[model samples]
Target: MNEDKNRIVSHGAFVVRYRAAGAYRFEAHSHPYLTVTSVMSGMLEAEIGSSHLVAAPEESLFTNSFQSHSGNGSDLEFVSVGITAEAVAEAAINAGFTKAGADIAFNNSYSSDRSVAEIARAIAAEVLSEEPGRNAMLDALISQLVIVLLRSHLRVKRSPLIELSRAGPVDRRLRRAMEFMHDNYSRDLGIEEIAQAAYLSEYHFARLFRRVTGVTPHAYLANLRLEQARELLINTGESISDIAGAVGYQSQSHFTKAFKAVTGLTPKSYREGTTRAVEPAEAGKAGLESSNKVSSGE
Candidate 1:
């Protein structure tokens, strides 16, 4: 089995990423957001907490905040939509869910909702295209998915007030570290430096940081740089090498490899909005397949 090649497209309220067809397995981990993965092809076998589930083409799988999930997929290609808990809460309120302040969770780990499948495919299309109004279109599509889940798939867990009030000194220090990273992401930084910003020893900072954010400091910083690089790719006409330097990558080759590894497209290709991995025609066929499955009661 090989590692999956991932392509990410970040939006305001949600992030959509595509995992290329391959055999891959991931260790048990958790996220602070709601993830809805729509299988475009092949099958996904996953374990979310205590439940074991399989999602097939035109079906979707859900993982709510901090719910431990691990999975393996064989020849699997999918688009995963990650919506923050905050976004879900907002949608829940809009959908008339009374317990919006409580923790939001999914009632089912797997979904065969036709509407969700449709919207997921639409989002994939938008991601693969450079169509005008792409941002607006994605916002609308993601909103529909959230609304559908709120109406049919959500459950609320009443949480203790104390849990919400855990923003103690240590948490404040973590926030400081995060702010430091954000402010200095364009420069080469080190773990010791970041740890110093949090006013903790490197060992302590690393441990608490992962415990809080679910990723190592280095991984977080890499993601931060890539995010900034992505914005530069989309919004500006900066040359690739200059953007690479601005994002703290010392060399163009290193920056290109990192960008392509995460995005499945070279920086040049992404900036051009011409992804050769999934063509427009192929994406359209996927949309049709999802629609046909709905009509045939699959």
Candidate 2:
């Protein structure tokens, strides 16, 4: 048995728990074996091949052997277990199955099956527990997990792939660019500045940023800033121009236009609609006086 800060490992099965704030992201990667990822709280967004989906609490995701997947999430907490194909392959080799294909593969990328989710969560909990003899307990649970995966997750209905393709992690340059935006969304930013932060040429960085996020850096930053603007609008009595400048927009007119474009309502209307009981003037401030903020000062 092996243990780490938030993980446990033994023959055939290894489990790990993840709990974090902000956003949790990983460039594209895959396990050398089959994996079951379960959401315990918040949400998990993943991309498997061409499919994009979100897993909520008590929901689970399954992946085939060597299946390529990438994802990111905010305020996420989840647990995952990987069933090692190398271990099984070694055992098969020792048993003289050098020519036999004894490793298993799963078909589905996502599962809401209560039984599977329950089992995955239980395994997660067991690995994270400090109780006695957990190594032995894990052995028993993993045996059962194999049965469950075979019974429910492994699909025989569809033709199986002969080999799954592997993709490299999201470029480090892109990660740097993303972090830059998160830190500097309130400042006037340009593609040239963001690309320089990533240490890449403007044209190269632009293409890769769009390829990874499906949006140009400008659009991405705009969306992020707008999201922050929405939060400020709902949670505080910051003036429209204050909120606009705080999130990188130089002009109130442009901010209003862009905010309305993404949120389907003008900033004033959104603030009013969200805080229905409050006076419209109090709900939508047009002044920059922090001491006169309605949400807190009143």
Please report the candidate that would top lDDT against the real structure.
1
Which digits, one per residue and each the tens of the lDDT, describe model 2 over residues 36-79?
Answer: 88887778898875789899988988875445577877766677
- Per-model C-alpha lDDT, please? 0.70, 0.60
**Candidate 1 residue-wise lDDT, 127-198, digit = tens:** 656665565566678888888888888885554321222221123448678778878988989999999988
CA lDDT, candidate 1, residue 164: 25
Clashes of each: 0, 0
Task: Give the Å error, residue 77, model 2.
Answer: 1.2
Q: Residue 222 lDDT in model 2?
A: 62
Give the lowest summed-lDDT range of ten residues in model 1: 289-298
Instruction: Identify the candidate with maximal TM-score.
Output: 1
> Candidate 2 — which pairs collide?
none
